[model samples]
Target: MRADIVVGLQWGDEGKGKVVDYLASLYNAVVRFNGGPNAGHTVIANNTSFTFHHIPSGALRGTKLFIAPGMLVNPEILNEEILSLKQLVSSFYLKIDSRTSLITPADVVLDKKIEELKGASSIGTTLRGIGPAYSSKALRISPRVVDVLNESFDFSIYKKLYNVEFESELWLKNAKKTLKDYASDVREELLEILSKQGNVLFESAQGTLLDPIYGTYPYVTSSNTTASYAFVSSGIPYKYSGKVIGVLKAYSTRVGKGPMPTEMSEDLAMVIREGGKEYGATTGRARRIGWLDIPALKYATEINGTDEIFITKLDVLSGIKELKVAVSYNIDGKEVENFSPLENIESAKAVYQNLDPIPKLYASDISYIIKNGWRAAPVQMRKYVSFIEESLRTKISYASLGAERGMTVKVE
Candidate 1:
């Protein structure tokens, strides 16, 4: 059968992990297509919270986990994650594609050094060696997972290039121990699953706005994060691509440095930040909070060809007297309804509309929505959802009310 893709429509942290975890049980396999340890997907299942950087979010659901070649594997971090997962779950099926590149200590050092050299212009990366690891792969000098298993694998080039003392022996030993059994070319198995009509769910790391190509230029992540890349990175043919599910937060939040046109005032940001616990799952840095940008959201959905939308963290916006949504941007005195990557987004002025806010949703309100569907939600909440759906010209199939898996309601 075809594989459905779940991707973040806004910035990287759109609660994609929770959505993937919520739907994992219906899939035969869950695949991580791109990114590395820099991407943190936090999933709360059975009251136990799991922050997965390398492993797929579906691990808690016991779905088959596949790390595709487009991913960069930091062996140490991955090993630690798997070990931790073992204590929470009974067992998990995992496979790392042999072609997946390894992130070495040298890469981490280089990442920090490069960001340091940038100084004021720093991209504010998670400092997980994601960029350097991807660069090594592009230069054809990175050691793949298969190379780590080879006894004769040489790391002299990496040491020479990065000018860092890499413990080749220790790194190789750990890599072998961690990946020997799990590393392989998984394309054939994926093909077999598709041939057998097995359902597969492709999980995307980062978000459309963080994609290297379509994103905000040099400020973007090292790899492609859009839904279309799911097929290219997962080694699955585009013909088998199914629904493109785009995940977005009720209000926008971004981590690190970037042009956020609709960024809220510091006072309002602090309120929402505390309410939503707006912090990076990987870096633990306070995220920049902002009002929802409809222009940007529409741009993301169009580029990814998103089939359905999933609005998350709706409860986070509760209790505010009024809510603001950016309906367009005033770029250089011109009102623009559409977002263009070519324009200077940082300087664009957001034109917002203040709408009536939903009163604080009690546990009972969330429970009612969960049991009675989206129509049962508060009038203001429904109005907010309807505005987003109308603005994007797409259906919102799901909306998450809380952090737990059961806190979600299907939109009808």
Candidate 2:
């Protein structure tokens, strides 16, 4: 009953991997509750950078990892990740829930075809067949991991997948071979750990703004990406959910297509993007950069019930002279306090308030700033952190100064 949750507060790629990896030593188990191979969590520890697509970030720490039933698992991607991680962490053992949806090769092809049909309106998915696989699950035509291992299971169910004409025999054979040893009824395992009062971490893939139910419409991931879904994802009771930590970037970045209110100018964006290494770990696509949007952050906090915030990539703002925070939106000449829906969001204009200049801070400088009040720190940096604390009413627990494990500074 000691489960904690870590969620991305901004768009996806809020550095949840580094946070989870850093915190893995405190937990006995780390479970990826949602999303699929499309989600990439890059962890840097012991001088090696490992990109995790289907495995939990805790895998490198020898923390027991579990892929929950809510995830759409690509057996091929999971197999590759398992093999790659084993090369680094020899004791890596990942459990897959028997009820996890199977993402077959046919699903990958169908995902591309659907995106192609969308043309200019594509949702900008990772094209890893996530949406299509979820769609198959909803239609009850998708096979689960248990079915994949069952000798008598019928493969014809998935033939009715979205009316697509395809053969899945080869895909099934590959999946069966790849995931033969990983499949298990992980619910019992998780329950056993919980019964032992084990500290468990539920790591969610995507951010609150990318959730299907709460995020911007038609531009979101196909599953619930909030902390509230942790129980449903892990088959645990809601009361066990303890800490809901929200990981946010100092600035904002989005991949693919979406209405971004605080997007910076292309020239300014490139400065931050390169500074922060803002590129998709999975697709290598450059993320769209923007100033921190307080309105969006406020909305995320409300939905996820964030207890504390972990700010990442603070070093990226080093060279920028003046920082901007999107306090509110001017939509159709009317100022709004809350985040708008996709229709209104498309036309929303960001209203920014400038702060003092934040100089290029050294690690020692940040450590100083975190311990002492921002009084002697850079004027703008002090105002920036203060604004976040006052606005969200949440403490900034950790600040990631750089990409490495030791680069994180704890706020006292």
Compared with the true structure, the alpha-carbon lDDT of candidate 2 equals 0.86
lDDT of 1 by residue, 65-150 (tens): 99999889999999899899889988889999998999999899999999999999999999999999999899888989888887
Evaluate all candidate structures by whole-model CA lDDT and list the values in order: 0.91, 0.86
TM per prediction: 0.99, 0.95
Best by TM-score: 1
lDDT of 2 by residue, 14-86 (tens): 9999999999999989999999998999999779999999888998788899999998899888878778887
How many residue pairs clash (N, CA or C atoms closer than 3 angstroms) in each of the candidate models, in the order given? 1, 0
Off by over 4 Å in 2: 160-167, 362-380
Candidate 1: segments with Cα more than 4 A from true spot: none
